[model samples]
Target: MLRNIPPLLSPDLLYSLRAMGHGDEIVIADANFPGSSIGPTCIRADGSTASEVLQAVLTVMPLDSFVPDPALTMQVVGDAEAIPEAVTDFQRIIDQVADNPARVQSLERFAFYERAADAFTIVQTGERRLYGNIILKKGVIV
Candidate 1:
């Protein structure tokens, strides 16, 4: 019902994004991510892929400018240097939507989970690809 909001963003998701302040993080998790069990507030975007969800979120939220890597992705297990297709798509979205040059950083499996646990909220998406989870830190508008 909102004028410029992405239709994919539900009321709860939109409210969460608006409530978050600078430096707060939100996780756009894949279908396999244990978002509910990790303990932070979890929102469901089960009809969209992680990439789709990421694109929509970046349209309304600004990425942290104070940090070197405000975006973090889960590293592929057993292959720390490998970048999955989902991660590639994430980077592409950031490049397209972010106001500044930003790149996605890889975090080890457990490290990524821990970070997600600490996030202000987690948006669990329907993406079926492995290593599709990404964490985005909020930044000031100015």
Candidate 2:
């Protein structure tokens, strides 16, 4: 109900994004992701697609520019060379919002899970698309 605030962002998710400091990472997980078990703080964003959640989050959150690749997506297992359709949508969203959008990097499935485990928070979306998981690093507003 807040004006200008993306309705897709739950209060908890908004707070988490605001509270995160530069370099802190947040995971936008798909329905299959075990966010509750792995994330330090998990926010439920059910009923929404990961692409929708990503676009909403990017409206307020800035992508980390200090790192070479601040946007990271989970690589398809058994087909590391393949790029999931969801990831392509993610990149398109990033390219639209980020001032200097960095190319999305692909992480091996296990590596992505390991990295998600260390994220500041994880937003579990309702996206049913396989390989919908992605991680984004926070950048200073400057």
Candidate 3:
């Protein structure tokens, strides 16, 4: 175990985060997400919830400040104006970790998928709640 490092972050996971450049995104997905089928570059945080994974990542990784919203969560289907409880928890977690706490933007289902596909890497979590997924952009250490 490494000192000051969240044990949840594996060497591979840390490697991915370290390799990512500013403005690159990393998706934290729900258990039901088709993470495997989506692409080859994915890290599995199985048995862990997405919020917990986000907290762990945010402990080390910085949030991108260039974008309007560094955090993007999947919007509830059939509802654009409303946010699901799952998303509320996600926003709370972000507020807990990030100093700036980028606004959590809602994306259409298809748009969320497209964003995840473009991410530098996807970390699949074992969150059972529907729509409990989000993408976070990487920022510089400074």
Candidate 4:
């Protein structure tokens, strides 16, 4: 067990995060996400919820300050204005960890999937909530 690292971050997840350079994006996907089929390298956090995984990741990883929105969540289908409970939880976690907490951006379902497919890596979590998926852009350690 590492001293300061969140236990939820497995060795593989840590490695993936470390290997990712500035601007590379990672997807924190819900259980329903088609992680393997979408194509990016996938990591499994099978027993944990998306919120739990996000909190653990934000504890060590820095969010991109260069972008207006480094954090994004999948918008509820047919209701772009709708904010699900998971998104709220994700926003709260981001606000707590990031120095400049940017407003969470919303992406259309298919758009989100396309982005996730192009992500540097996708971490699949056990979160059961609808629209629980989120994407995070990695930043420099400065």
lDDT (CA) per prediction: 0.94, 0.92, 0.88, 0.92
Query: Which 10-residue span in candidate 3 carries the lowest summed lDDT?
Result: 33-42
Pairs that collide, model 3: none
For residues 1-142, what per-residue lDDT tens digits would candidate 4 score against the true structure? 9899999999999999999999999999999999989999999999999999999988888899999889989989889999999999999989998665778998999999998899999999999999999999998896
Off by over 4 Å in 2: none
lDDT for 8 (candidate 2): 89
| 54-76: candidate 1 lDDT, tens digit per residue | 98899899999999989999988
What tens-digit string does per-residue lDDT give for candidate 2 at 1-142? 8998899898899889999999999999999999999857989989899999999989988998899989999999889989899999999999997766889999999999999999999999999999999999999897
Quote model 2's TM-score. 0.97
Please estimate how well model 1 matches the true structure, expressed as its whole-model Cα lDDT.
Answer: 0.94
Residues 29-96 of candidate 3: C-alpha lDDT, one tens digit per residue = 99999887886388999989898899999998889888888999888889877887778998888888
Model 1: per-residue Cα lDDT at residue 26: 99
Candidate 4: residue 137 lDDT (0-100): 93
Best by lDDT: 1
Whole-model lDDT, model 3:
0.88
Which ranges of candidate 1 are over 4 A from the true structure? none
Assess candidate 1 and give its TM-score to the true structure. 0.98
